[model samples]
Target: MPIRRRLGYLPALVLIFFLCVLLYAFQLHSLISTSRSIDGIEQTADQLDNYKDEPPNKAQLKLQNSPLENEADTADKALLESPVQDWVKFVRLSDDIFLYSVILDLRDGNMDYPCVRIVAIVRRRQSITCNFAGNSSVAASFYELSENHGLSYGAFVLSCKIPQQIKPETVTSFIVQQDETKTYVNVQYTVTEKVPPSMPLTYGICIPVLYGSRYGAANLVEFMELNRIIGAGHVFIYLQHDRLSAEMIKVVNYYKAKRMLTTLEFKLPVSEQIIWYYGQLLAIQDCLYRNMGFAKYLAFQDLDELFVPYSSENIVSMLNPLFSANSSLASLRIPTRYIKASEEELAHPPLAMKLTMAAEAEDVLFTKCVVRPEMVFEQGIHHTSRVIQHHYQTVALPSSFGQLHHYKNYPSSVSNERVPKTYGKKFLARYEQVISELQVKS
Candidate 1:
């Protein structure tokens, strides 16, 4: 499809043209313009006095670099070239100023091949037209490789082809959202300095969650896994039930036994009104106190789900320092898709749901990752009839690859508890059959 040409496009083009004119104007005048511009009548007396850098505050300078990261002067091409310490600017295709994010090495300036990491978020300003689900701001991130060409700008990373899946629509709202913490990252001195400390990069699995299954082992690793299991971490389960079910009670014990469950209820009550702090929330708190370890991050998902890796880098992340600004929850929205269920899939328990994208409900799935455990509402926040209450609004998802698989939608299910029967039965049976059909190498 051709680019949607609009009146807005003109301004952007014209702005670029005008900015070029300004560049020449600044360079042409040069030092002559700098002198009088600082005076009260021209530049203002305050501007003249303030132009000078204040004496360096040694105490404030102490926490300047992190030990884990290489020294500022290490000469890492990636670190030196990335946007950081005032050398970066974000621009949109339309010439509008878009505030995304850029991180540069803040170490000694004498290094080469500085390790650079630039995560770019692209967004078109146009509003959604059709198939719009409440006009969520579609957005995507691009890893950038930029080179400063002697006052001329040279972009090496942006030119490389980005895979189709990773490209996102221009966000309607905002991203890498502004936060005090993101605004300022500490660039501590070299690791040898013992004044402050630095931490290694830690990650959280983004769970495509569902509520209770009333069955399944409590230990998350016992049933399904990807490579390995954790001793304890946040598991965001989507409890679709308005209240705790008798079957779910048994399920709750599963997590309770592993010391890993936090039951969250997001309802308003049409009939038997259960207050917060009842089942799910109670379980979460119980695990925290009993296990002697609190959940670092809880994925609100169902029992049938399991996370898979989508990127070359085992972990795909959308985390920005700005995530802290929102409430204790981060939204996890999966671009809905589906998987076909076979006859064997339907063979077991009647009404068994499937995890394919087709196994979804009328409502959209914009799950919020549980951050602060204490903040887990017992009754969950408020919701209409069949949805997770939206106490913490959603922030646009950070990636195209950051998604999980859902096994059982109610209509297609052979059994709810036996969910994701695909993995348990279908997949297993299929594997055995394939193996049997294959000729032995011997």
Candidate 2:
């Protein structure tokens, strides 16, 4: 029983201790990584705020500058023969004339109207006539279809606007043939995007809000409130009565507010009584009834968020197939919190926000933000969809409007000379109903 005998197990004990530590560290790291991912969605800077647009490097892709023509150009024919490899885009500077400008999508909103590179393409004339069944005489108008170079199959000018309910198998358009003979391009396209059972609800908007707009950077609520007044829809239509905030509202001029509203397809018929929250609810009902099969961007942003669908021209094109597969569900926005201040205004280096176990050590993660229609709902007030995201395709909408204009997002504006206490008071006025409702029982 000497001291040496007791020390015999020391080596085994040390190995066991090391193994335990390794396992513990691995588990801890995993937990910490998962925790951070749940809260943070944005990955980095340098991303366009277009959260749902497709991903393509404009450099590598072969972009169509004008419509591809099967026939040779007599005048601009010489310009059409350039063997360009980049994703080139061109516009007809002149209608009948052949002045073309080559454009590139720099992929940033700040870069207005990209630098236009002039290119040459000959414009040819093909005499063609179009015939389609129409009560109001078949009209003809010219539209440049391809941005590539020439007409793939002659200029497919639309004769007349087709009715929404009717589907015409063939559309007739008059084309000018090099031949003085009368000919027409039988433009045919199946009616895509079935009107979605009259989604009385056309507009869509969502925000991750609870009691307040604390989640966003600042002033997010103000934007939501403004969106409420402007009413959500395409540029033409404006809805009233239906509120997008789930937060209970007092008996005020407005009804209940929610993060989202869809009255486009409500079981209830559209009536003046429920004006406040009708259209938004209908949109939701329409999506559920007829638009469930509609895989395209089923949702859109409230007025402020610019949503451009895939311009690939293919009818059934997917935005980013790698991320938006038919995995248990659908489209997602890989949200990124892009700082708005210019490089000169940047007070700190651009770093993606991440949660850390130790105050110093930070780790990046993949935050899954799968946003869908069913996942979108009105829990009580503000409108929002459960977000889904991926690295390459999704974008965080950078806003000077301060995260949809929330009061909490005011810190950035604090330093601005333009902001005064009165402005803040007016914003709070928008939410007066919600404040009163949440005040107390006594």
Candidate 3:
């Protein structure tokens, strides 16, 4: 009886042991599966951390499905299909009037709506019709931009409000209609868009119309080198193509190839009726708007003029501190120091190093400006005509900082002084390099 009872107890113990082993195996399987799940979650988190700054492919997929992407596609399509207009030459609209460009002006603080400004050289006052997209038409208001120089034909900006139903960005072209002697003439102009967001250039030089045959390639090369040495990132020249020489064109093409110069072909429809230089203000307006969102600061002066710093190596170094100190500074009025070119120098133009004799600082009337283009509404040859007055101010820089070295022929009786030798050595080195390069190229 005792043996039989012991055998019954053994079987029961074996059954309990088997049940414990099964429970242990089940727990080990669950633990391994949970560990794998945790590892996967950590890997996913690491991937997110790696792409925190820049979105991953998944994010791009989301953007591709967004409404903003659709809008961008539509804008791109509209731009591609828009009619191509010649923006380089002045289009003849009538006998006495010519259109230069059509620009979307959104800088008006007082007006609630945007307007299209038609840049033209109008000899006489006349009413014109501006036709927009969707068959909308409005009478344009004329604003004369003469700086009181008393030229027969001057720059006029014909402004017409954009139709409320039409979007400004969608506007690619507009038609101008003028009634002349019971006959109507219609001319279409491509509209230049508003300012962009990215500014790639920090400093630029705007040279008014180069219309005379007197300027040679040598002097132009010297001027460009000098300005480049003094921190001119880009130079914009409005070339009256028919007026300039082949040598000048070659030099322009060389600089353009290097991406340092941009030339806009400029011509007058009726050159005899208008003084050639009188259209400088019009070129300035075009350049101002062209560089509005492209360059941070633009120097408005001729090829013969240069901004020379007193102590700093470049103009940017001298002005950076001032800008940092005064955020509202819109322009810097650099006093002019006239450097009289001798007869010999004029006959055979010498390098900037040879031209040292300069005049004392002149009054504000003879000053030129380096302006922040976005802050200026209307620019003049020597100053800004219209600026956002509420937040912007023009400061006249002292001679100690810098001066505009104007190299030209002056009367012998005028007092003379030596230009500060701040940049003479550096300019000489760079000028020599440029001469050597030109000689090699030739």
Candidate 4:
């Protein structure tokens, strides 16, 4: 009876225990919910306080800290300013305008600064800058002038870092601006393409001779042989006509076979060939572009002219000091000392004999030259018209160094100082032997 009474009390006691545990759990849950609500209220209050102290917008910040304000300030400053053009007083357009290209060899031992040089011919004593409309401004300046010859002209090479960025097909223009005046003249521009890579030549000659059937065989032989003796690396001759003497043909064939000379035949209708001088200019320019890859220096001259160096026998040896002295030397004008043949020599007529035996200097002409392949663009018969301008002296070689040997007309006065027959004698002898053999064969 006692155990039953205890069991019945146990059920009521267990119910009471369960009810207390459930009430305690609900109180704990309520406490956590109230704490979370208080935290949310505090966060809202902190956000409201932040806005009251300082607005979170750029309008309230300093101008330096605000990009939009800085932009506005810059725009206002620009509006208040005038256009800034370069100063333009001393520079002006040249009366004779010429444009051209050159193949410049920047070879210093292993490092070569080879580039296809562009040039513009102008007239001004002060340095002028060239600005390519959308391209680079020419950093080079005029290093030469024609003031001594009673002419005021300058040849400027257009140089800058932007030329390489120019597309070959892009058609643009350049403006020539004077340094002081900042005055500029605009001209059409055609980008000169770089020549195909090749082995560098020490010296080369381009003789744009207008040859025809009536051309003298002996004169042609002497011209080629003389250049060969002077150590011409390559010789280019443009034959303007079809007919050639047997001796001339033999000489051309001999040099061509030796790979020392190249010949191009120029053929055109009489109407197209109306101007002989223009034809010559075109031929010379063509020869320049053609040989840009093959030569370090190129000389454009007549077949009758020779620049014999007094210091050294060959032209190459004379060039070393000239180049060294004027580091930026592009074109060098060596005075021409005309040596007219005697009447007795002219009567003989071959011309080669006259050159061999001629003595005494009669007239002196001071403006014939050989130019660095990369510094000249358009070549005139007597001198180069367009050259690159750099910060270096572009004076001609002094007459003391050498003078041109021009063989034409009769000697005005005879002197004991006869030209030594020994200069280029070996080549002359070979040419004579070849002509004799060809004559005998014919």
Instruction: Give the best candidate by TM-score.
Output: 3
For all the candidates, what are their Cα RMSDs to the real structure? 30.3, 25.6, 15.3, 27.6
lDDT of 1 by residue, 1-442 (tens): 3466666588899999999999988887886666656553553334334322221332332233223223211212222222222111233332211222222222122221121212222222222111112333222223222211122111211111112343212211222222221222222111111111211112222222233343322223322223123112323343444455443454444332332333333221211122222223222322221111122333344443344323322322333233455643434344322233443443332112333334333223533242332232121221111112345444434434443444433344222222243234543443333233332110
Instruction: Kindly provide the TM-score of model 3 when superposed on the true structure, using C-alpha atoms.
Output: 0.72
CA RMSD (A), model 3: 15.3
Per-residue lDDT over 339-362 for candidate 3, one digit per residue giving the tens place of the 0 to 100 score: 878645754544356666655555
Q: How many residue pairs collide in each prediction?
A: 72, 87, 0, 11
Best first by lDDT, ranked? 3, 4, 1, 2
- TM-score, structure 1 vs. true: 0.28
- Cand. 3 Cα-lDDT: 0.68
Off by more than 4 A, model 4: 1-199, 212-214, 268-278, 342-366, 390-393, 414-421, 440-442
Which candidate's lDDT is highest? 3
Task: Tell how far residue 220 is off in model 2, in angstroms.
Answer: 16
Worst 10 residues of 2 by lDDT: 349-358
Residue 70 in candidate 3, Cα distance off native in Å: 38
Model 4 per-residue lDDT tens digits across residues 207-301? 76555433456556666666666666666776643476566777676655444566766442222333344245545665665544446667777
Candidate 2 structure quality by residue, lDDT tens digits, 1-442:
8889889989999999999999999999999998788644443222222211122432222132234334211212211221221111222322332222221111112212111111222344322222334532333333332322233222211223343333432333323222233333322111222223332323334321122222221222333443333333211112222442333222211221121322220122223232233223222222222222222234333322222222322111323343246433433442222222432322121111110111111111211122333222211112222221222233332222112211111123222211222233443565444435554111
Each candidate structure's TM-score, on Cα atoms with residue i matched to residue i, is 0.28, 0.23, 0.72, 0.53
Please say which candidate is ahead in TM-score: 1 or 2: 1
Q: After superposition, how far is residue 320 of candidate 4 from its true place, in Å?
A: 1.3
